[model samples]
Structures are given as C-alpha cells and as structure tokens.
Target: MSVQEPEARATAVSPLGTLSLHVTGASGVTIDVAQAQVPKLPEGMAVDGVMLICVRLAVQITRESPMRIRATADQDGHPETGEWLESMAFANGAGRLQVAMRDDAWLAARGVAAEPVQYERQGFSQVIHEAPAGTALYVSAAWRIDCATAAGDVSAWFAADLALPA
Candidate 1:
C-alpha cells in the first residue's frame, strides 16, 4: 500500500467480529485479520475444556525506515506497553506459535519492504476456561516508524468476543 497521509487512521474489521486491526499517522501501514480460530490440538496435546485463540495479522508497512513494532493478545483489559508477545509458544502441548514479519516481494515490487505478520495466543487460558464464549478479548499491536520524514507512533487493536468452536 502507499504511504498513509500524515495523521490519517484506517480500520478494518473481520466480518464475524472475531478480530480487527487499525493504524494511525504516516507510518504507511495497514492491518487486517487474516485468520482467527480456536485450533484443534493433537490427541496428546489437547486439554479438556481448554481452548486457544489464534489470530493472524496481515500487516503492510510501505515506508522505508527502521521500525519497532510490538504485538500481544490477552483477556479483558487492553495489553500494557510492556506486555509484548513478539514470540511465544502455546501452552499445554499445543505446539509452537509466533508472529514474525518477512520480506515480501509483492510489496517490494511496489516499493514497500515488509510483509504482514499474524498474531495469536493461548495466553488467556484462565479466561478461556472461566469465561463463556463471546466474552470480549483483545489483541494489541503498536508501531514506531523511524523514517526522517514520517517519524511517529501508530497503534492498532482488536476487541472481539471469543467465538469458540463446538
């Protein structure tokens, strides 16, 4: 995508209210919910009555500059600045999970450098077990773009009621 106009903000939401992402300022970034699911675990890795929230983020950063981005997912309250989940593995034998950005040739061809990344979590195990499905949970992401012409901070989040599979 092209560089966002300075101070401009954009928001996109999934059709089911399962998740969403947005951005602000001239960071030249956009976010979308690529996937949101309660993944099925392998027989041994499964935990009775427990479920996990996995969210894949489609992020595009077009501005060429070093940037620092942080992402997290959890229950109830919004994630704090320090609660960064840059890399994490699911609990209870649910295998590994991560949100990593890669170089995208598609974006590169158009002059953008970074590929979008996904976000997910089992960090709210207690909430999963205790709260009924449809309770609100949040996924937070923030970015600090450092290009000389577009130095600013942009943040995004998703506040969705959990949709647990039957």
Candidate 2:
C-alpha cells in the first residue's frame, strides 16, 4: 500500500456571511488564506470590512529531540472595536512548556490558556477588542518551532480559521 503527501490548501471555510477563508498546510507546505471581503494590498491598499483572527499550535515528539514552537496573530485594528488572537505550542523532549499572549494597537489581551494534551501537546492563546467603527482587524497567525532532545524526534504545526461578516 502507498500513501500521498499532504498539500497546501487554497480555501478552507465556506461561509454564508462576508466569506472569510482559512488556508492550512503541514510539514513543509505553504498555505495562502484570506477572506473574500479583504482587499488586496501592495499594488492596491484597499480597506473595506472588519476582520477577526485566531490561531493554535501543537507539538509532537516521535524521536530524540527537544521541541520549540511559536504562534503569533497580529490584528492591526482601527483603534476602537478590533480584536486579534494568536496561539503557539511545542513538544520538546524536555519536560517544559510555556504559553503567552499580548495586545496590539487599541485592543487588549483578554484570554490565554494552555491545553491539557499528551504526546502531541497543544497551546491556545487569544486577544479581542472593539475597534472604532469604520475600521478592520489585521489577522496574522504565525508559528515556529526549534529545539532538541535525546529521547526521540519532534514535530510542530500551527493552524487556524475564522469568519467575518461583510
């Protein structure tokens, strides 16, 4: 029997609202995810609707190596009613773990919790705020892992999805 490798996804969530998208990838893949109402930047900086973002991460040890993971969600809001959420996780062969969250712009950190998991450990972090009408949130969910161990190996992944009414 044979198996195929995972591929980067283009679209993740199908919604009845403004249509926010989630792109997921594993191992060494790149995923491009965005909402249908989000305006394209760089060539044309256009801002239209408001947005909310969230992220989570998990770490797994299969070989002899420590794990290092980091997840970040930066939501540039309109300084009144915007919110952002970011989370990260890592499974180092070492018996140690940490989780944290922060605020950006006019928003504040609301909640962050470490998930109770075994083998494949996970961490959850989030932030929320209401931006001043007529502005949107910049959702950025980013993660990274780096560490070493003497027992086995380690693997880390970060994934997230969201919905925003246009």
Candidate 3:
C-alpha cells in the first residue's frame, strides 16, 4: 500500500524541545478512543483483499493558553512498509483529524471520486486504516504545538493501541 498527501500541512512556527504525548492522567489532557468498526461500504464498493476499519478519537486539550496543534499518524504495525498518511492541523485549537490514504489505484479501485478528507463528525474525526484482517492497529498521534513561551515550543505525542476484533 502507498500513502499520498492531499495537501501541505502547517508547521509550528518555533518548534523546540522534545516531542511528548500526554495520555490519560496527564495534566490538562485526556484522550478518548471510540470502538473500532469495520464499516460497510455500498454494494460493489469494496476493494478485493482490502479491509477498511474506522478508528475514531476525541482528544481534549484543556491547556489554559491556546496554541496551534497538528495531528499525524503512522502505521506502526508495519514499520518498514508503513504508510505516512496526510496530516491535519488546527488553528489556535485542535480540529478535525484524518490520516493519509493509499495510492491512487487503491482509491480508484474502491470507486472513490475524490480524496475523502472533507468530512468531520460531531467532535471527532475519522481515521480509516487499511490493515489486513486479524491484525492489531497501533496508531501514534504525533502532536506539534507552537507556544509563544521560550520553554513551551515542543512537540508531544499520544499513542493509541486498538485491537481489532477478528
């Protein structure tokens, strides 16, 4: 499989320090992952040997000061052949999040007319993974924050390991 960049993502103005990920129990940060589901596509819309699962996450960044945050994911399950999906960024706050998709043929075979990154849900964004059946998904959310403080220009990360039901 291949990953494609739909558009150029924004970068932190003054990124500094080491990148970090704040999971549950981390001060002012909480991440909630929804159940993984193998979505049912329309009739004749499925690609042969390609299984798609939707992973949803709702991350609340309750820091007092606002900063620009960006989100990206890596298919850690297969590092060597891992895919680097598209990156999503929020202005002064975290907004929608979506990973990069496979190659054009992979998408075209599934009858996708355009890049599927324009949709957003109530407070969460869809992260569609193209993993083989009976495999676990290890998605790492690499977050970059651009704070105005001298000591606050650092990147952080939070990992979500979801076991797909066989």
Per-residue lDDT over 17-117 for candidate 2, one digit per residue giving the tens place of the 0 to 100 score: 11122222222323334433332333422222222332322322222321222222221111111144232322233311112223342233322222221
The Cα local distance difference test for each model comes to 0.26, 0.25, 0.24
lDDT of 1 by residue, 58-115 (tens): 3332343232233333322221221122222221122122212221333244343333
| lDDT, model 3, position 28 | 26
The CA lDDT at 164 in model 3 is: 21
Best by TM-score: 1
- Candidate 3, 57-86: lDDT as tens digits: 232222332112123232111111112332
Clashing pairs in 3: 19-155, 20-155, 20-156, 20-157, 21-157, 85-100, 86-100
Error of 3 at 142 (Å): 3.1
How many Å off is the CA of 54 in candidate 1?
A: 12
The global Cα lDDT (0 to 1) of model 3 is 0.24
Ranking 2 against 3 by TM-score, winner: 3
Q: Which candidate, 2 or 3, has the higher lDDT?
A: 2
What C-alpha lDDT, on a 0 to 100 scale, does residue 131 get in candidate 2? 22
Per lDDT, what order, best first?
1, 2, 3
| TM-score: the better of candidates 1 and 3 | 1
Report the Cα lDDT for residue 87, model 3.
23
